[model samples]
Target: MTANPLDDPFYYLNNFQRVLAWLSQRYADVLSSEEQRFIEDFSALPRGSQGLLVRMVMRKGLRFRHGKLNYGEIGDIGSAVAPLLALGWVDEQAPLGLVELFEVLLKAEILSCLGHLIEQPKARKTEWLQALEGHFSQPQTFRDWCPQLEDRLYSLTVMPLCDRLRLLFFGNLYQDWSEFVLADLGIFTYETVEFSAESRGLRSRQDVDACLFLHDCQQRFEAGEALEEVVAQVNGLTLDNPWLERRRGKLLFQIGQHGERIGDFALALCIYRDCTYPGARLRMIRVLERIGEYALALELGETAAQAPQNAAEAQALFRIVPRLRRKLGGPPVPRSLAREVERLDLHLPRIDPTLSVEYHVQAHLHDDAAPVHYVENSLINSLFGLLCWPAIFAPLPGAFFHPFQRGPVDLLNEDFHERRAELFAACFAELDDGRYRQTILRRYAEKWGVQSPFVFWGALSGELLEQALDCLPPEHLRHWFLRLLLDIKANRAGMPDLIQFWPQRKAYRMIEVKGPGDRLQDNQLRWLEFCHEHQMPVAVCYVQWAEQGA
Candidate 1:
């Protein structure tokens, strides 16, 4: 086997020591032997592995490590790589490698390659930028745009060996400029969206658990078992419960959701008023919106907004405010969310420049090399429209990260999780009331639809209800009642809507829904009898599906 360049202690140590000296001059503490070793090992990987390592390091940035690199490491790496890439030591063809080298270079404040790149012609520099812009603007699926993208980049007429090499890091963002793109030139890409979905401990486990729950629930529901019983079964299964801290709130919200599903507004309202966690507090606002309690939901949302500027709080407010207006059967929005999503839109300055995406094309200067082309602009706009932009509009919690890209390589490590959690909290707080709801609750509802998360919500109703009810004033809830009464009078949720409720007969029937089957469950019958015995009228009602696809 060929010896690795990094295996030589002198080579890595000498290089690593110099970088450490550079870092020490700026930092208060001296570099530890462990950190130095990690830097050396990271820099010594082969070209392909180096790319991954560099991104991993940069994502972790400036931190000491006991095990794998953590947030501090990611921060340190970012500080180093951003400048290094802009300075041009880390070429596009080897982003990972370049990131490592750049970190060292930036720490040293030594432009070893900058002197070399400066010798390139001015025309070549301009051409490189144009090619990069072209590639970025085009929107074929990420992998499909490689050929055209790489061709424009790699074929640019830059002179001097160093300038050519620097092109690598500059184009890292382009789909065609990736190491994966190069690997695909002669090899077929495995078809699947999950191509890059590697297991990272808790997240992967949660995904597995959720899938299992869904499978079990489907089986039970299909077997004519009650949905509540199935919910109980899934709720009892305890695998990895990272969400335990917020469990009470989450469960209360879920119970309220169950009430909503069964058309038990009173029960739903009671559950919404009993939960006490942040997650549950958010959910109550959503439930209120769903049951035509828009004004009340809005007030609850406003209360959440006052507590913090977190993404969840902001998103809840954002979505609830607009949705309430719509549910109150108001006129069309003057501007859709997409136009107003600038609420939480973050802008991270381009701190440095590196390789342009054409490195994939440039790599083909070797015998097996093939030309890489980036997808053109119109298509890129479409792809962003379909993928990136929609996420912005729906703005889920922790969705809008601080645009540093490349992270979570050590997800199992507690430090990384804490850092991620903290960052998520900070980002969540950035949204105002309206945007917070839009990002957290409304987006979650749309993404999960009227299902899944709702079931999750059902398990935690008590905590959620208490928090929301406590936060909102009784007068607001009373006003909401009056408005809902008006809506019911105007024929909402099918009329004759909810005239009264009575305990004598064990039920309250406001509207009787009749369909093709025209059947009622025992619960419904009990409710009807109770209402009738107490002198409340049970009105048979008919309604139409807005559309037929279900």
Candidate 2:
């Protein structure tokens, strides 16, 4: 392996070739006819032409100006682009509207093109765009739009095709070619897990199309398209893939949240009724109450309370259900008393205005005997990740598909823990037998800088790890790890902001800090409640700046 992958001028091209080959070999059944042709044709092209095409595909936009495109490795831009234009992969006569034109041209060019219509010559590009929006309803070739500006624009007509390939490789559209560059630069590293027969994210052509459709729907929804229209189109498609189904649920959940934000309670209720996304029921109860349907809200809340989906929903119900009952004019239900946690009140001088409240408390509480680290959620999560590394990264069907994945695909899925129960049980057994400390430390050293969803390596120091291992007992670690497994998504967050460890006593205290006017959030309350129930040493620290509250 090369120390620096980019030392070879064709590094990016090499990566692209690897992806194409991987897909051709592993995903041959799923590849569309057009995709297969592109792969075959792309491979046969001269190295320069291949490099140039990869450069354009990796870039932000489809349109590229010949003068702006320069790569010494891919010498002679005009020569490189000839084969692409011939293949119709890159178009010279692609139409561009005023908005697209404005993005490419300089201020002077825009002024020259539409100076007659502009009331103010010195106005911003946005104002000029609005001034010309109605004038040019039709899109024209960049040359036709700006004939006076002597520059050639090449637009890649195969952007949609490239995007499909990218989606297949990354398993999603959000991650792109930048992942390759990051890995090459040694900024991010990923673990290699064995891929099984069913490891691929998109197993069929229909699955690929559905994933692309969802991507387009998300784009349209974010671009402020008509809500009902987008929702209708989104709801029209029925996906068989559970992963895709979860994505659809999440999109609908977001749409429902947006409706609530815009005070569309009826629409939110309609969405929540059918949406299976986690927390939709909670949102539904709130929406029902918002629209003055307290009885209905109570009905649903009570039903959910009987068997809440997760700790988050159960916590929300505990608060909302009683208030909802009172709203229905029923007998006043007593508020359930909160589990008391250790409290620390301080009015500390703010020496560094740049530092956060958690840091301020950490600095004040630090000593030679007791060292406080602003760990927040990183320490525990990192410890759990390190100790349970083998189980988490174990190769299972449908878990790992690509070389770049940070964790298993089913990490957030409901059955993630159940699928790997035996592996996790073995890992947990290490904690019971006092072998967890060695396992965690060994994994921490070996897997250092490797990507993990749970481990915050930047926040985890060797000293902190050693201190935590010495102080935190195996039983407490087991409790925390088990809670994380119960609901990985919900329980992973909302940990205390600071942890002070007493290595001499083999003791530690997690402290959740709250600044002035900052009350505990629902998640924080849930974590505090959990700690209280488990008899863990945790505290809630309230800080009032002396300047304000003295």
| Weakest ten-residue segment in model 1 by summed lDDT | 150-159
Once superposed on the true structure, which residue ranges of model 1 sit more than 4 Å away at CA? 1-215, 218-225, 238-240, 243-283, 289-299, 308-550
lDDT for residue 408 in candidate 2, whole number 0-100:
92
Tell me the deviation in Å of residue 530 in model 2.
Answer: 1.4
The best candidate in terms of TM-score? 2
Judge candidate 1 at residue 328 and give its lDDT. Answer: 71
lDDT of 2 at 161: 91
* lDDT, model 1, position 342: 8
lDDT of 1: 0.35
RMSD of 2: 2.3
Worst 10 residues of 2 by lDDT: 1-10
TM-scores for the candidates: 0.22, 0.94
RMSD of each: 27.4, 2.3
